[model samples]
Target chain A: MALSADESSRLGELLTSRAEQVTQQWTEIIAGQLRGRLSQAELVRQVQELHRAMVDALGKGTVDLNGEEATELRAVLAEFSRGQARQGFSATETATGVFALKEALLAVLEVDQSIETLRDYVAFSTLIDQMGLFTFESFVRTRESLIADQAEQLLELSTPVVKLWEGVVAVPLVGTLDSARAQVVMERLLQTLVDTGSPYAIIDITGVPAVDTQVAQHILKTVVAARLMGADCIISGIRPQIAQTIVALGIEFGDIATKASLADALRHVLRLTGVETARRQPRREA
Target chain B: MERVPILKIGDILLVSIQVDMSDQTAVALQEDLAERIVETGCHGVIIDITALDIVDSFVGRMLSTIASISRVLDAETVVVGMRPAVAITLVELGLSLNGIRTALNVERGMELIAIERADEPYDERDDGPIPEPTASP
Candidate 1:
């Protein structure tokens, strides 16, 4: 049905007010739920449900408002926005927690924009998103710093590799392989492969103080990522506990070439390629 | 041999090292670095390899080994200053100083060390005995 000019104006105002109400509700819901201090799984589920309920309450169509009601609706929406903007703690991205709140806020904020002129709404939404994105960027940066802090403490190793060698790059690792350092080791190994021209890299963990499935998996991925890049990767550090963890975690690393030591792996590489090691003596004459 | 007093920055130990990495002296230089780290009770060791033109496997292995041993002593290690070409050569030879720490110079290494030490329990005395490097098989 074609609407009269008065009705169209009324519809836009109604939509605008509804959007603002929904956004305010989103902030409230997030704060209330967070205050509950629920477990991560519970928190995510609650947020999802809350989002659904708000969407349902707003309904799909126009909420008719008289010209006078239109003015009141606009004021109510402004009030709600101020309320929303006034409060909101730092968003956590670990469980997509902050993302969830942002998502809910945007959904309602979009409603207001939709009711307004197209160009105005676009600018508004973009500005809001930029602010939200900046917040999110800082949150991710903080998370990365926390992780790197742990890495420095545990790995006692160094460098962000410029690139991975394409042929063979040997990494001889010693000491205990904690999860944080293990991840750094894994990333460096893989990144070095991706960055360099080398095809085969050896990660000799003969000096690793200990290991578990997590560390083993880190080793496993370096090899896998290497193969994905068309390189043969070798892992040379297999402590007894690491082997047992693979069994315990049921982690399978059958594809990676495992050797007992770096020198041993280098020898095997020479053997397979029909190249004699410089250190190997010629066959002794009887 | 030039000696610089060791500076304690929080829980980390930083000792500035001056090793001339000339082709003739690189081996002795490596030993000197390894010894200073062992002697100074530092938790993070930075070896300045900025003085050399060419770096061969022996020096590379020494750097890599120094990093490994420091970890045993609960210290992080970094090797800095090889000519760009030498860095490329080390990569080409597959003598990856992998799983070992690296820095552009002594200053950056110390900055990293400072970051490492800042996390210790505040107010706790850092005056404990030097941590002994673990025995290798």
Candidate 2:
């Protein structure tokens, strides 16, 4: 329920009169919940900022948390929750930090047993509940964005087109080839082919654990895309089981070269490029 | 319509398409390339698309038609320098530019044409062992 003008002023006066005690109690409660994961001084500073913002909002007679007067309060709460999230705190623990204020307020309100004080406590408890929910939401948002950034970084880190030879590049795919990663691999490999003008590319799937039909299809599409750009793609690193699986699945690589290993693939490309590597032999005569 | 210039380098006609291809421009290119091939009697044609950012179906068909026309005129055509994005788009669209040879760049394209031309005389010769004349009485 929205706080009336009288209730707002009464709560503001109550908070201001016992500001030091309330903030101290609130900080202690949060510190106990965090179990020293956060330092005592930092916790006290955060609690003081939140306490001051709330009092300022109440002083302006703000009924709803969405009111213009509550802007500072919301900002303080959002920053606190975001900070907590980045520190690896759980959502419940972060929300508890805000909810601890209710306990601190109840301790102060328990001294006054009047029915009017009881009603004011309930209204103030609802406001604190709203603030806890706001903190929870921002915490989740911060966590979600953190996950998204990590996912992008992982995608970039996984697919690397490295030059293995003068006119040959290789993409050593080390993980599962999902559609998204496959698309990235295809684009990066093709772009590298154009940028480096490498006529040959070796897609070493040694790191690929399994070759399902879908994975094979992604690989085929990449090879075809590279071919269309006038570059030849050789699929290397075929595990024995993967070869069996490929044949059993009736997936035809059809004219696109497949090698047993990256070395074999490199040798094949070198031969095609007419770079003869003379094999070393031991002398028969001493 | 902007005319795509065709440069004749030795026995190969080089067409570097730098502008966006409209229908009229593509047709003009087809006509110009055909005339240039006959006038120079070039044995090879290299179409460089390094600057073309897009190659829709129309341009694709134009390439195929030009390839077919040059083949009829006893010349080989090699399409080179297609951008990766355009290649992906074409592959997605299922246009593989059939009957047209492709190379990585202009240098490779020239090498390809030279290789084919050099092999032509050998291909015409019968390298297999000759059969002994029958001694029928």
Candidate 3:
């Protein structure tokens, strides 16, 4: 609800006159809600900043939070909730931090009991509720962006193309293969082949728990892309159950060599390159 | 039209595509490569596309057609040095460049051509099973 002109001015005057008392009570109420998780000094600082912004906004006769005059107030509230979100505070705790100002204002209005005072208190309470909702929105936004950043990092960390030999590289997939991750794996594997001039690549799925048809299609696409870049890719580390799943799903790897282990794939590559690896004989004891 | 230069290195003709492949340029390169193969009597053709950042469907089809032409002329055509991004884009576009052999680089391409040329007499006995190590007495 938009605050009326007289109510906004009177509330602004009351807040300005009792700024110290109102902020102290607001901080104390929030500290109780938090149960000592946030430091008293930091909480007090945030409460004081919020109090000044609110008084400034109301003094300018801002009817709603979206007014240009209340920009500072909106910024302060957003900053407060973003900090709470990063600090792992719940939405209710962050919103309650904004709502606590209403209780503080009510304490100040308790001395004057009239019909006008009750109306002013309700109008002021609605404004504080608007601020609480705004804080909740910013908190949720910050949390969502934080999650998106972590997921991007995980995608980067999951698809690492490492050099196994002079001309052989490997991508050890450790999680489920989605289209995005598969695209990353394909691009990275092909880039590594071009950068290192690797003629052979081994895609190890030993850490992958399952393989459906979609995953098989992704793997096949990656292999074909690598082959187009003039690198042979060997699908390795096929677990017994995963092998059975592949057959049951009717997914054909189609002439791309599949090995039981990375070692076998490497051996096949080495032999293809004419590198004979013979077993060493034991020395006789003297 | 910028003609792609075809250099003769031993028995393999190396066509390094340093220019962007326009429709006319691609057609011209195909014609020039076929004539060079016939005149030089080269047994292998290596088309290096390392500098090519983009390979659309047209270029992909050109490569396949050139491979077919060289094959009919008794020359093995190997497209080498395809960049990873181009390869991924081609696969995404569903163009595998069929009938065109591929190698990682020009050196590997030459090696591939050498192996194919010597395929009939090349011995596979060396890659046979290795004998087990004997136990010490």
- Per-residue alpha-carbon lDDT of model 1 for A1-286, expressed as tens digits? 2234444434345445565564455455555645644455644454444334323322332122223323433333333233223334244422233344445445655655654445444433342343345445545555566677876665644433322222457777766666566556656665565445454677777676666666766666555444433346677767677667667888777856787666777777767556754666789899
Tell me how far the alpha carbon of residue A96 in candidate 1 is from the true structure, in angstroms, after superposition: 44
Off by over 4 Å in 2: A279-286, B22-24, B122-137
Cα lDDT tens digits for candidate 3, A1-286? 6998888898899999998889988988898877656888899889989988998899889888888889999999999999999988999999999998889998999998999999999998878889999999999999999999999999999989888888999999999888999888888888888889989999999988899998998999889988887889999999999999999989999899999999999999999988988889999899
Error of 2 at B58 (Å): 1.9
Per-candidate iRMSD: 11.3, 0.9, 0.7
Q: What is the Cα-based lDDT of residue A229 in candidate 1?
A: 32
Q: Write the per-residue lDDT of candidate 2 for residues A106-208, one digit (tens) a residue.
A: 9999998999889999888878889999999999999999999999999999999999989999999999999999889988999899889899999999999
Q: Each candidate's DockQ score against the native complex?
A: 0.01, 0.61, 0.68
Residue A173 of model 1 has an lDDT of: 72
Predictions in order: lDDT: 0.53, 0.91, 0.90
Error of 2 at A86 (Å): 0.6
True contacts kept of each: 0.00, 0.76, 0.90
RMSD per candidate (Å) reads: 21.1, 6.7, 6.7
Candidate 3: lDDT of B32? 94
Ranked by lDDT, the better of candidates 1 and 3 is 3
- Model 3 chain A poorest ten-residue lDDT run: A31-40
* Model 1 TM-score, 2 decimals: 0.29
Q: Give per-residue CA lDDT, model 3, range B1-137, as digits (tens).
A: 68888999988999999988888998898899999998988889999999999999888888889999999998999999988888888888999888889999999999999889888565432448778999999
